[model samples]
Target chain A: MVFDKKKSPYLFLLPFLIMFFSFWLWPILQSLYWSMLEWDGLRAPTFVGFRNYIKLFSEQDYIIALSNTVSAAIVYIGIMVIVALFLGFMLNSSILPGRAAFRTIIFLPVTVSLPVIALVFFIIFAKNNGVLNNIISTLGFGRSIDWLGDPRINLWSIVSLRIWRASGFYAIFILAGLQSIPEEVIEASIIDGASGWKTIRLIVLPLLRPVIIYVIIASSIWAFQLFEEPWILTRGGPVNSTATIAMHVYRNGFQFFQLGYASASAYVLTAIIVVFALIQLLINKGK
Target chain B: MKKVLTAAAILLLSFGFLSASGAEESKAEGPIELSYWGWGPHVVGVNETISPAFKEMYPDVTVKAEALGPWDLMDKFYVSMVSGKGAPDAAQLVRRVSEKYLISELLYDFTGFMNEYDGQFSEALNRDVLSVDGKYLGIPLDYGPSALFYNKPLAEKLGIDVSTIVTWDDFYELAVKISREYPDLYIMTQYYPAGTWGSNYYRMFMQSAGANIYDAEGKVIRNNQKMVEVLEFLYKLHADVKTLNIPVNDPLMWEESRKNNILFYPRNSYFSGEMEQQVPEMDGVIHTIPWPLWSEDDDPQYTGNWGGVALVVPQKGPHADIAAEFCKFFATNVEALTQHWYTTTGVPSYAPARDNIIKDNTNETFAKGLMEAITVREVGPWYYTDWAQTEKILGDGLDNMFGGKLTPAEAWQWTEDQLIKILGR
Candidate 1:
């Protein structure tokens, strides 16, 4: 029997298309509709137009959440990219001993569950008997620091957790990119009296731009959508210092039962993330 | 074309078989199974003791109790209620948040069934809190009367007399003395960063002062005097006495208790169960006392109610009547209540079952404190539909105050403003 190529391809894609429409597209459209109404999950929804969006913008808690999310994303992406690049270069070097072991150790955190990591970090950051505080005190480094309790340091602690868990994964990607650079090109640069650092800065970095760009955009999205670590560790507290935009959406939708407001905040977050990705793409395109 | 036809036929046959089995199961005349959802030791009690006794009594109705963490249970229940699917036949709902469910008309009206059990449970809980417009939506399972759980050996070692610490002023003085005398010892555990701890303490103190975030008419009280006082007291503990600020339910609290570095935990009746479960080694050494009064001369000495759970049957459940009967049995039956007390160590709100559990209890200090707390004049927070939001706002304000970002007065005002803005009240 003869098969129609076009129809056969579509038939093969049918399952994936069905799932995508049912789970992803349908919810997105439904949430957009819900974003226009003032409904607690239980009651009849009343259409409130853009009032929920207006109120969301004017909300102090939403403002704080937005600011926290943006700042954390900036800091998290910056540190993650730098650390990943350095580790990638080190691992790619032929002279580094036991590179495989270092790679395994670095990538170990990525395999463990996030909640487990957060829980372990919670104990380590405890005020009195925490390992970190105990070590500091043992070294006579003044009083015990409240890593999770202090508003000033709690968000940074969350950022540190993100970096610890994710930097290695991105480093692996950067290492692959580094390996793709031919040895002959590097030798030519060195033979032309270009020092190692200079050869890398002018030559290696330009070729690795695609991988770095991917890392920055992906990590940025993750940073904006951060929830589990903050939710488990600090619960966005000490006066909402560590609360992110995603936490705000969960609190409003599930905890406060304000479905419309939560939906509005969520869409706003989506827009911000889109704009960020676009900006990154445009910057890369210009370069 | 033949392959496609065969695949389609197989899929249709499979679905037909699935539907046939589902229909057969629905039509079969078997014993009814009531699904219940809850959390903590109470759920353990329900699964272990209550279900067995209930099965023995009914002979036709069986219960399947599923346990989850408190917040996880609440989240699952809320999602089920919202989606109008996957809800249990019966679930344990916190009394403080039950008003929201009541207002949403999600609970089965138990007025008809509960009328027969009038005066069986405590009037303060059943009549005043669990009912709305004479319609009963839930049965009181337990009442959380606040108390101070202290380490008796630690108190003796510090030369502190628990009897003299009857007032808040006295408690504060004792806290200061303990801080000065034993640099490593903390008087209590308070978490400044977590809003839950802030709200818990705020609710305890506010109810002790005979006030709440809401007035009698359900309007939020702005710049409440009682709230200011409570915040000031909490601030002093956080700033002056340097109370050990640790997250609630953190393992560190238990570790500190074991080491005698932390002496007092001002918690509710449910905490006795927690202590028994978490630090069982300190059972004989630890004792409970009534919550410290606001002043020595204050009349009646009202204590605050912190946490309690109620058994509620959702309106959408398939077996509402049977579930309500099970709930009633769980709450009121002496045998079931006794077993529940043994498992949970929680003071049941059912008056008739009270004496039975309290009479021969091994933990006499806890039992006595529970009895005193129940008999004393108590004030419970007014849980409105917006109570969760109000609690969060209040908690954030308290967090700011304790973190030194706002003064007590400023925190009170900030909380009031936030509530007004958020609730549109």
Candidate 2:
């Protein structure tokens, strides 16, 4: 019997296709459908026809959550890129003593569990007896600051946590990009009377563009979905100051049982992330 | 071609075998196993006390009670209900949020069983909280009868007699005196400008004044005089006495209480367990008193509820009847409830069981306060489907008030307007 190559290939792909369709594609389609209904997860759904989406736009909490998520993401990506790049350059320096030790120390937070880190930060940011406040007081600071309680500073605190957890991990990626740059290119540039800063600005940064773009896009996506840290630390509190779109989705779906509304919020979040990633890609391509 | 066909046949046979194995396991006859889900001390009660008692009553059946985080338990249960699989036969659900499930029609109707056990549980809990269209969907496990948890040592040190505080006016005066004398120590911690806990605190005061976010008819009463008054009192407490601005449930607040920096804490009976667990050193140092009345002339001052849980049997569970029976037994059996009390330190909603459970001085004080303050037939607000949304709106308004951006009346009006716009009610 002759085995038809086309049919054989189709058969080979069948299992993966089935799994993907069942798990990923089906859920996305179902969520999209549910986004237009007014169901409470178990109740018979009513055809709401974008009513959930309309309501979401008018809801102040959702607006605040969207603003917080976008602002935090922008700040997070900006700081993470700069800090990671700096750390990456420092680690890549041959003249820097204990380079391996410094890399390990900086990258340690990446290996630590996020909940543990958030909890540790919770203690550190405690208003009265926290480590940070204690240090401030010892340094003759007049009073303890309510780091996690103040609405103005709470979102920044969450951003600091995101940066701390991820900067080291991204720095390793940056370090890899730096290592991939041939040593000869740098040596030739220096031989041709190029300053160190000039070489990095004109050569290293351009070459490192792909890694930086990837980091920015990945961090933006992650920031839009930020939940566990703020949840464990502040629970998006001090008046929803740090509530993210993902947190709003969980609240609507699980806490409020507004599954349809939650699905709508989720789709909006997806759109935002997509638009953000596309903008970054377009900018990179333009450059 | 032959090799591929053989591999496909083997895979098909393996799938068939696995399917057959699952079917056989389902069909296997033995002792019936019922899964129960709960959280916190109630889960402990179910696993250690209630489940054992249940098994003793039904020797042919076994009960497996799984303890999960409060939010995790609800999330898992809701998912299981929606998927129609892997749900616990019986689960403990918070009374406030149970309305969402009740409206979903996914809960087993316990009306018949509830009727049989009528007059056994507290009338306040059974009135309309767990009922929908006259169908009882859950059995009341406990009630969070509210009270004041005061630091006895600190009160004595400040020469303040908690017994003399009858009205909120007296309480406020005492708070001011404490602020004047001990500037470093706060009279109480308040969750102003915070999330659900702040809303809860605001609601507690509202209930104390015989007002709530909704009336008995389920209409919005959030902008009423009583609500504004509650907010006004809270604002005054914060502005004048300089109450520690922290969530009562926060670890920082508990730490402050442990350090004797907080002189008083208004909380429900469920906090009795929390106090013992969170601040064990304050076992004797802390004591309970009835919550002060809203005014001197307020008749039959009602205690406010903070948190309570009820046992529910899901309609989709494998053994609905058995689960319902188990829930009834767990809730109404004096012996099981006595065990529950020992394990949870909770005030049983079953009135008869309340008498059987032994208590320490603090718990006794809490119980006495509950009996005295719960004189009114109805206790607290009936949490509706939009309760979570209401909480967010109210919390935001409280934050504004505490932030000095809005007055109490302005905040109350803003919250009501926002609620009307969002909830369309």
Candidate 3:
């Protein structure tokens, strides 16, 4: 059914278009404008013209947090997507029993609220009598490690926790993707005497490329703004090792009341994320 | 979209009505609404408990008491006062707020309130509040004379005598002994922030040694050889004792850290409630002893914080008389405040409140804690007492020494560099 040339193309979309403009579209434009100004969220904004961006260099914490965020995005997405794919394959396989029970267990973290996960994990990672320390001490180490205290191990600690908490959600996405793969294709590949390993590598992996690409792009975008986990877990301590760009933006905006500076950081973050996504897309296109 | 506009209109109308009600209900002529800010689950609980009574007595007058939590509440209040809106009628100020918050004109000078209530308040409260700028800022709500909290079970387990642990050397020896034996849990600890270096080690210990970090006026008189000795000694403790917390991976770590991991911390009565919140299992094991026997004759006894929350009537607020009345009533009411303290589950600032709570108190859990409150000491803050130097110069200097950024002698030089920035004289 082709639209009549006389009919208004936007007539059907007017309500949603208004909503999109008001809620999503306008805020983005406003944020972009505010990013250049030195506004404290209360007073009239002063146009600083990239001074906030320049100060980002002197801020040791912001620089460290930026690196931490980049690393988290790469590591979290890499492991989570791969593990999710593998879990999807295993869950759907005939070799696995009680798929319902297995799926429920694996998907538990996805259903759990992020704050709840943070609280539970914080309890588990407590430096002294926490479950982890109990296990470690039982191994004859005879000491509790400063899991959140020592600057060296703090960021890695957040990374491991993020992976544990996020992988299950990714698992569901990949599982749906796996289930969507045609049974007839696998049957034909099997009839052609493609080994199981060879089939997964050559046929299934390449075939699942679109779904995998979707998963990576979507998950990486979310991962780039990782905040709550690091914020709650370490509060950007034992000395700013786990501070992320989003966390810095949040603190400066809310706690420090430096709204303009926070906006600048956010805009820069958006730029970084866009560039990363573009480069990944370009590489995938070349591949 | 038009529906949304109508809804926005309705919301704006409702907000307008709210502001109108706020203005209308506010004191027009008699007994105005006094908005006060303070902390202590007790103060919060006390305000709630007393509200019925307060409102009952002053039917026309209303007092809104806002209670903020421990860590960032002060900072939030400072940001508000600086930004110029939504401030309470009166605010709870720390003794060091003069420097921490350098607003000269905004804060109400409570010299009049102090003079009027001089007869009503306790001598200790008056001394602490009156000492700052020799002018009072606010009325007293609660006090926080910190003591050395100990684990009785852990102490018994180690066969330690609390009596002998008075001097820095004596405390150090016991820590070494505890470390050698336990090896896993920390023997003694405090949070390693750059700010508390002078308070915990220098001022507190110096006060014990009978010295003050500064003179009556802000001066760097604390740069003595003994100060160097304490800083060096504490930096070495960072190496000797494992800090109460380990890495962030272990789940039970904070509980154990709050409970069995650390033997002692230089904290106030607030720690009692916090410890209970964090580790109820160690309730019986925890005990508070007076800040371990400081010798304060020779040194300016570093009794920095007597922990009082002041109630003030803002010069601009609608209800100055009502706010003052509430302040007077709340301060004098020992029974109501005792309940507030118990329910807030903290050490009461007033001596009578502590005595009332401890008298025939059947809950054996916090009984010994009640005793710690019973032995009230007045080691409060020195106002205009900018801790910036002690905090920046002395505290961060300790961290720097620990990080191997500066040696003990070089730390002295480095501290001198920071002294100028923090003190600016």
* CAPRI verdict (incorrect, acceptable, medium, high) for model 2: acceptable
Give candidate 1's TM-score.
0.90
Q: Cα lDDT of all candidates, in order?
A: 0.80, 0.79, 0.63
Worst 10 residues of 3 chain A by lDDT: A6-15
- How do all the candidates rank in terms of TM-score, highest first? 1, 2, 3
**What lDDT tens digits, residue by residue, belong to model 2 across residues B304-328?**
8775778898785668788888888
lDDT of 3 at A56: 81
Q: What are the runs in model 2 whose C-alpha is more than 4 Å off?
A: A1-3, A111-116, A123-146, B1-28, B103-105, B157-159, B192-194, B358-385
Clashing pairs in 1: none
| Candidate 1 residue-wise lDDT, A4-102, digit = tens | 885677567656655565568868999999999999889889999999999988888889999999999999999999999999999998899999999
Q: Which digits, one per residue and each the tens of the lDDT, describe model 3 over residues B289-402?
A: 666544434243334342445555444455555666676667657767766566545444555666676674655534255444325444533332455335434555554566
For each candidate, what TM-score against the reference?
Answer: 0.90, 0.90, 0.74
Best by lDDT: 1
User: Candidate 1 docking: what grade?
Assistant: acceptable
lDDT of 3: 0.63
Off by over 4 Å in 1: A1-10, A112-146, B1-28, B103-105, B127-129, B364-385
